[model samples]
Target: MQVIDPVTLDNCADEPIHIPGSIQPHGALLAFDLEGILLGWSANVAQLLQLTPTLNTPLAALALPAEVSQAASECLDSVEDGEAPVTALEVTFGAVRFDCIVHAYHARLIIEFERRDTPSDAVAAFALKAHAAIDRLRRQKSIDALLQLATEQVRAITGFDRVMAYRFHQDDSGDVTAEARRDDLEPYLHRRYPASDIPAQARRLYTINTLRLIADIHYTPSPLVGRAGDVPLDLSHSVLRSVSPIHIEYLQNMGVGASMSVSIVVAGRLWGLLACHHMAPLQVPYSVRMAADVMAQVLASLVQSMEARANALLVEQSAEVRTRLMETLLHQDEPARALLAHAPGVCQSLQAEALIVTEYGKLVVHGDIDPELAARMVASLPAHGQDMVERSAVGDWPEALRPALAPWAGLLALRFDPATDGWLLALRREQIHTIRWAGRPDKVIRTGPMGPRLTPRGSFDEWRQMVRERAVPWAAAERLAASQLLGEMHRASVAKHVETDRARAQLLAMLGHDLRGPLHSINMAATVLQHGGAASTMSTRIQASSTRMERLISQVLDMSRINGGLGLGLTRGPVDLVPLLHDLLDEARTAHPELRIDASMPAALVAEVDGDRLVQVVSNLVSNARHHGDHGEPIELMLDERDGKVLLEVRNTAPAIPAGLLPTLYSPLKHASVGNVRNRGGLGLGLHIAQEIVQQHGGEIVYRYAASQVVFAVTLPRA
Candidate 1:
């Protein structure tokens, strides 16, 4: 006896189970290239087929039965057309008949021959049974009903002791959702199995192969014989492929003599399995297995259809909720408050117990949950690169926070605005339950022929485990609905902001127009008093105040126009900026005598521009610096040319703007504070208007801060 290496949990997943270089003893395998030269053959082929297979010799020369030769030719034609394997041919070898299945893989044609014990007319009977089973499955209304019926029908067809409808969870673990078994046998329904029982590679193979059968778990394997230099054949698509040793041991430990699995695939993914087990060695006919495979396919299709219908219903319900939320948002001034007010509808739509909306560092929760605990949970959530975070178990949370959040086991969080740490969270309270498992999932390390390693448990008794601190899982449709709700909320919030901005602009326009007439009267009165022997100081002061008021009104009107989408009107001409800068600096000195200003520029630089608009830009920049800059430091203004473009830079010594506020700095009506003091007597539209004017001139303006110096640089084409 050969001493094979022991299988351990660490290396079991890596075991190359697909290419076992052998076949089950019940069947014989032959491999030949497209040119008909034999490449490999199972050791049992001579006994099963009554002919010896010679390496590198034409299969025709070996004198296979005429029926097999003809079937092989037809199968090759179908394989060339990209069709699946063919298994319709049966040939008589002496007195016994054999079923021949053929497929093409890795540039080789593989033929499998298995003894046929069924009647010659079994195919017609299977066809009728399959049609009736499919009709019954299609008539079922619900997925549960369909799956239950499917298990029963598969059990009746295969005559297995037990038939289970096993569902794979998102974590790859399995649950026997439905079952059909002999009345005397213990039930395996509602039992859970750990994911390690089916390794990743096995799951992948299941997806590709659709059906697998082990006729007799106690039977020996017939090894394949090939040339010395040839590699192990890829038996991924071979029907007679040998079983993995570890899997055989697993089934033996369970006292299962025969087993088969029919994959339930949906949308090209392995959704679940129809697992059949027999206590005695059983050999199911090929026709019967094919019938079970058809039923599973029908079940997969029906499951897909039912799930789609359910998801569509969820989508419609969520759409209605979103519409109602939008209407409320339109009527109310605060979006977050309106959403919270309608939280019940939103929560029900998403199947959540509570809804929490976090906006601008404020939490508005609407449900039976503690606000402080919700805040802590929100703070502890790690950033997941903009992906939605869904959890159903307390253990899925951070270890330190798990104990605190033990009472709440489900969390679905969507970050709506990452800039403001805005998030929408849904929570569900924990529900404790008990799970029945086939056995204790923990494998035991036992001494084997090779060494001590992990082995399947010997006991087949039921094991009950108490599960706590977990909630019912969120369904796929629920996740989709939550994502849609978040997106719609964002859109509604943006629309609300636009509506508010427009309303503010209209109000400003009206206020600025009304103030202009009064200012004109004040200016006229100041002019008359100065010339009519009044105190020149008083008249001058009145005139200066009126002039300042008029400029403020002009700024107000400009902001209104910009916010209203009517941009500033400009008159273009060539203007000398050197004198303009000097006059602006002189005016600034007269306005603030205590503040120092530094200037650097060319003697005379001419550019085509709206001189008044350009001055407004320069003045606003200077004023903004004075208001926000450190009073103890000097403000520097520089004008120069670079790379055939005119450059204007205004630098002020001050701390850089907060990173959080920088993104919305130039938004209209936004105010920033410097050392806890708000901007000095302005509508907070200086930078916004400046940027608008610069962009209209086909130029760009950018803000940069370094070493406590804030710089606003404007680059304009020299033309």
Candidate 2:
């Protein structure tokens, strides 16, 4: 808006620069340098020195008048005296109002702007007021008082009609906690509005950012064909002067003409909104809202501190109460029901209203004496067997509970153990507020010895009501209390289960060990006789049968030991396996005289292994072969090395081990049909131990069957 005259040749040469504002007759100033260069120019400089490009342009193009150019030239020339010129002017850029100031200190000039008209001392005065008020607030300890102060400060500073703390509830309802209104406006304190009035998207957007300003929510947005600017007019921000259409529609629906929502962050979370509302249309400049944002940030930490202190106090109280109750209830020798039956008395002693205990409605008990009325009240509660969970199938708490406890009154329901389906109720009595049980937080009762006020037993009706209430069944708190009480009782009732299992295990272990000693000696004697028996038929048959009986006893003992985790110790050493195999062959020759032995092992197979255990595994396999295999064919033993592991195998020419028995060959002893000597002989411990020992040394025992031949192979890590 400023116009400049052209600079003549003489003026240009005499002055290194003629700043646009100095030569142009506008409300702005400019400074030029001695190098015939315009260092900085304001809006007024546009008349004398026109800029080619708006941003970062040179200052030589304005058609300045000869006299104005001469004045600029003189100013530039005087730079030898360290003096610079300044000018002020009004300018507009793409519809933006910018008041400009230009000043040259040395080589470079500075351009400053005021987007809006300002009173010089308004800012400094505001700082003093805000600082003093905030300093006073900093010394405040009460949250309610601080909230009041902050609302007042915001209303005064912003000149808004209404400034309030709007708290968002889980149900999407909001309550105006602190409200400050203009002198003529009606009060909006303690008013609540459903959050439904603010669409879901609005809440989402509010939380997404810290500050939102709809200077005039009713403002229509100007459509742009690709607007170009650092900022637009928005409900949130205005790079250019256009608001979002969707937001405008949303605001209209909410009945708000103009609004600015400042996020109230507490405990590192968006607690709610500090909403400034104006019923009449109003426009707030960007600078004002930005200041509000800064102020909000200042108060955030203070609010956080207050919330933390309150939460800490709550936790301390809960812990103290829980400790005391647990000491009284959990470890008591008496039954839980008996212990909890006294809860109503406890509540009375604590000076509470209508002491009620609910175990999710499973167990309900009340210190209240209106037994019949209490029963009806509890029966209608959203309670089942758990304290906290209202019956989902039924109506909600406020709805169902409202009509239920209309006879009692109090505030602050003291709770305990919600996780385990139990809650203790100790309602505060000093409060005029009525805390009808969940069914009805407003339930009222007379104030006598047995009633809510707990006044002196002046009349007999109070005592009668109390006595009558004691007989009421299915009370919500009583039922819930009973449910939790029952859970505790059930647990306490069966607490000795583990000890019983341990006793059984011990018995098995003792019987197995005690009974095995005699069986072993009998088997040894029978075995010696079987191998060396003469032609005495009776003596030989007796010994053979006795040996089989001994085997059965050993099987039972082995199974008992294995099941009880009585591990057998084994010795590890280098064994010349060729001789051990030879000895085993000799034993098989004596046991299964008809069984032919085929050996393909080396003359000397040395292995770092438990030689005795290996001997047992081999012996068991031989026994299995003699009993089930070689029904008419001979058995064979093969030893070799494969994949760096020593292998020992015993094969039988029978029907590849009864398929049904092969799978369970090394499993625990079942109540199998005892008939053959082999069947009755062992409890499959040899194969079990063999597998275990080899596995201990990183080895395994496996079976490979083909045709009528069954092969039992043991693979061990080779040394």
Candidate 3:
């Protein structure tokens, strides 16, 4: 057969066209023209179902799947009907996906086979043809068509069951805005999934990687990382570790055998999920998966481009929410509690509840402090209990920090600004309880086991983890303002802490100077009474007063050292606790013999602490109880061993720390209960001094109020 080359650059992309390798060994060519003409034979024989140039030459036929043939015929019909000469059709051949574009000019059809792969190269070509389509959209100025065209492009290139652009809702759940898939996947057309379905651990990993593929739930899972030959190994570029096992189990439990997902981002924010599923184990070739990824990118870009205007609307809508919150915070008449009661909507706007505002230890604005779950968590970490705190397991946080907040069940600390001497904390249900992702067809980029390939996966945990890295969705106009607010809050908190500490040091310095003179005078008086003609009873009373003055001086001095940044010193060595406690107890009782004392410690208990500082810590606590808890009750000092640490606790029953004075005890500044009916007077530095001394010995002293009784506990590392 003499013939000029029919394949050209027009027949394929940049590369040379790959003609279906020679169909016949004898070289009697069988080729069709765009006009459906078999040039080797007369045109009259072209309509024959099976024909050969020579009657003796038997026709060899290739069996094509029914879907492919029908798709080809439809494309040809469109051409004959005076439509485009070549029309693209999406079709399935067994488990494989294909893109078939049919051509008809003569009496014969020339169907081109472009596998659902090389979507990047394919997009380059389509962008050229679809430039007009894109222009149509630009003219229409309609986001719907923009999304629709992008979806069709992805479907044509991926051949997945169903592809969708699912948007995240105010709740964790999402809605499907665009859908493109095989007709068989009608169930996922506009479906939704609960955010609870995707756990927190899974969300955090999504931002680092792309491409979530669950070939089959029944498929044995190999280690996501590490070398295992014959497993398509690529440690540096693997996608398994990026995927979460928990989510894989979730998909398996959900009866989904296979799943693949990608993320769609709009304006640098995670917009939605592009999800795919298969009923059985599915293994897509790298080339095919990559093609889908490229196609998804184009779709995501188009959608994002079209939604640029709508983003402005979203920003405007949030104005009301922001104003309400600002109003609540700035309200002059209403306290934070009243604000919460009258403007619940405002609190929700900040995604917080239980906001607390304090100037030093005094509560100026407080909505909810003792949140049911937050209380338990606070108790567990007493050292952190006093700070303006919030925690959440849903909405946006990492998985590593979940266990610490589990007891709180999504109670989160809002950004707190001490500059205003106020805090914004939240105690609310987790955001995951409200929102979910259906699927996002536009996102072709993600980070994970897939190594920045795609998102949406069989492992729900892995998928959610990736989502955690999602950027905040505040619009550009709002972002600057939001950042300013967050910064202001942080700066305020730090400024307040500094001011409180500075004032506290000044008071202690003055007290240290003033009290020393009187303290020395009292000691001289006591000494004279002891040896003078004065009675022994008079000597004891004088000595007691002298000791009280000494204690007040020591409290003042400890505060000065801590405030001056002297910090703690280390003298690491084994030290016996029994002798330590007994000696300190003797000195304490000598100062106030009338106060009862009890000590419990193991005979051989020892720890690593500064001996002199430890002594001071114990003595200070005893002295504090002697003065504060003057109810004539025995003060209990409990020492026990737990978790390899020696615990020393001082217990006393007395008037509570005047409620409002609780926090200022540690604050450098002295805080008095504003209008407490109970008359209590003290600089509130006893516990602060004791805490510093204990810490210098590498220990911690904590105080807890139990109704009328206040317990001060100190723990040191056991050696």
What digit string (tens of lDDT, one per residue) describes model 1 on residues 1-719?
A: 97766666656677788888888989888888777688889999889888777889887787788878887777676665344465557777888787788887767788888887888687668768878999999999998899899999998888899999989887787899999998988898888887778887788889888889999999899999975116788888877888788789999988889999999999887789999999998888887888899899989999999989988887898899989987776654435556787888888888998888876555778888788988888887665576478889998888888878857999998876564466888899898888787888788877778567677666657898898998989988898898898787777667766766675775476456545655776777667776784566656766675776776678778876754446688788888889988998999989789878999999999888888899899998998888889877999999998888889999999989888776556655553531125453466567778887897788978899977899999998767
> Which one is best on TM-score?
1
Q: After superposition, how far is residue 400 of candidate 2 from its true place, in Å?
A: 10
lDDT of 2 by residue, 298-327 (tens): 667677788767655644544444445544
Residue 304 of candidate 1: its Cα lDDT? 96
* Count of residue pairs whose backbone atoms collide, per candidate: 0, 83, 65
How do the residues 502-576 of candidate 3 rate in per-residue lDDT, one tens digit apiece? Answer: 766766565566566666667677677767846666666566666657656666666655544455454667788
Q: Name the runs in model 1 displaced over 4 angstroms.
A: 1-10, 80-84, 228-230, 381-387, 398-400, 447-452, 497-719
Select the stronger candidate by TM-score from 1 and 2.
1
lDDT of each: 0.81, 0.51, 0.50
TM-score comparison, 1 vs 3, better candidate = 1
Model 2's lDDT to the true fold? 0.51
Mark the regions of model 2 whose C-alpha exceeds 4 Å error after superposition. 1-115, 119-121, 227-257, 279-285, 335-364, 369-394, 397-719
Ranking by lDDT: 1, 2, 3
Report residue 42 deviation for candidate 2 (angstroms).
26
Residue 581 local lDDT, model 1: 85
